[model samples]
Target: MKEGAKLIHTSRIPVRWGDMDAYGHVNNTVYFRYFEQARCEWIEQMGFPVSPREAAGPVIINASCTFFVPVNYPATLVIRMHAGEPGRSSVMTWYELFVEGQDKLYAEGAAKIVWMDNATGRSVPLPEAIRALFDAAAG
Candidate 1:
């Protein structure tokens, strides 16, 4: 974890057989899905709607991942989620992926989430509840 990065959630996801490609390893795109699962869990647990059709909600501006080792099926993955300091309307979330029972890092990822008005498709200030969560994590 980076300095000042607060771990907010963790998830264990099983690697599915279909996650593998012809290369016999988990497909590169699947790594992002794993990250998304962990991130979504965190958001939902925070009492935020995963998808809001008419109200302000969160949307990803950008996302990225770095694969250090290829993961295979028959494995349970532990994904640790971290949050950086919040901005007015955005926050940077980080993730580290590891196979269960292993200390090695399989991948690391990040996504910048911005609060947006669903009706107007415009950025809006993050909800106070979210800012309070960051503040609690920081302390």
Candidate 2:
């Protein structure tokens, strides 16, 4: 895969009416939600043998997005998900957002994720299965 082309999962999100702020643009917070959708979808695609109950316990250590063109209602938002650089006990999720049917980039960025033992709430090395997910998805 080319740099910035390692898409492990992708989806088109329909712009929601409520995503627009009073200024008639998608609010800054909506970018985070869009990135969340990409990450969740990628996790599901990895077939990690997880149920919703088991998946709820991860931490977002960091996240940010850079905006360019604006997206509006009734439009399709294309989201691409890929793995980022990993450390001893954490990983990053990178997202590239585009306007559907066009190459216009609306925004792009990443979130730092750390896995924790559910009971202890302490950071842990990502499990082997999850590591495989990164090996397959890392750009």
Candidate 3:
């Protein structure tokens, strides 16, 4: 992670009671789903609506998360996402989850998404429109 990482999107998620474990903390596995929720919102904001009928879209090739502090139930999260500069066929996304109105981070993660052609089920170059949207947001 760099100090200059540009956050391109932000989303708010409520921690559900089901998200907690018997230990009274959010389960580690649930962080990935939170990241996915924020990532999908980012994709839609960038004008690429993800849907079953879409011909092309970004697919998560890899995802990982690192928990900082344990979060219990009865919390609201503000998830921030940064979209890295696009490569030929892929882009990296970074995320940070924080308690609403709090500065401390509860979790952070990154995901590598590659453009794919649903019709062919193969990787494809990022469309020019998508690249422009990212560029504009980065600015």
Candidate 4:
């Protein structure tokens, strides 16, 4: 996280009725669901290398989240995500949530994931193909 970074994907989440808490506001955990969807969309859009028996090769090494404003249920939430430049064997994913049609930023967060060798269970540098995908995604 640096300031003024470029974002890759944006996903709109319609807050479900069940997302509410007793106080009539969207539950805190619900925000993470938005983050998950945003990340999934980014990966899907990249169309990285895939094999029939192989899966996406990485594990989240760290994650942190912060909330600035509260959003009530029955509203639409917009989550924007970006993958930062690759460093060693990892990539940093940044996120921000906006409520009320981009009028307000409710939260900002990040997750760091290390490219990994699934068979060996070790962190590995991102493959060149996947790195290119991220570069393209950054645009």
lDDT of 2 by residue, 4-102 (tens): 535567878888999999989899899999888777666666654334356334577899888887778878899987665567678777788988889
- Global Cα lDDT for candidate 4: 0.77
Off by over 4 Å in 2: 1-5, 48-57, 136-139
Lowest summed lDDT over 10 consecutive residues: which window, candidate 4? 48-57
Lowest-lDDT window of 10 residues in candidate 2? 48-57
RMSD of each: 1.0, 3.2, 1.4, 2.8
Off by over 4 Å in 4: 49-56, 134-139
Of 1 and 3, the candidate ranking higher by lDDT? 1
**Comparison by TM-score, 1 against 3, better one:** 1
After TM-score superposition, what is the CA distance of residue 84 in candidate 2 from its true location, in Å?
2.5
lDDT (tens digit, per residue) of candidate 4 on 13-132: 898999889988888887777887788766656664333245436567877789898888768888888777788788888898988556777998898867777777778787687677
Q: Tens digit of lDDT per residue, candidate 3, span 90-133?
A: 98889999999899999999999999999999999998987887
Q: Please give the distance, in angstroms, between residue 22's alpha carbon in candidate 2 and its true position after superposition.
A: 0.6
**Which candidate model has the greater TM-score, 1 or 2?**
1
Q: Which pairs clash in the backbone of model 3?
A: none
Candidate 3 lDDT at 48 equals 84
Q: Which stretches of candidate 3 lie over 4 Å from their true place?
A: none
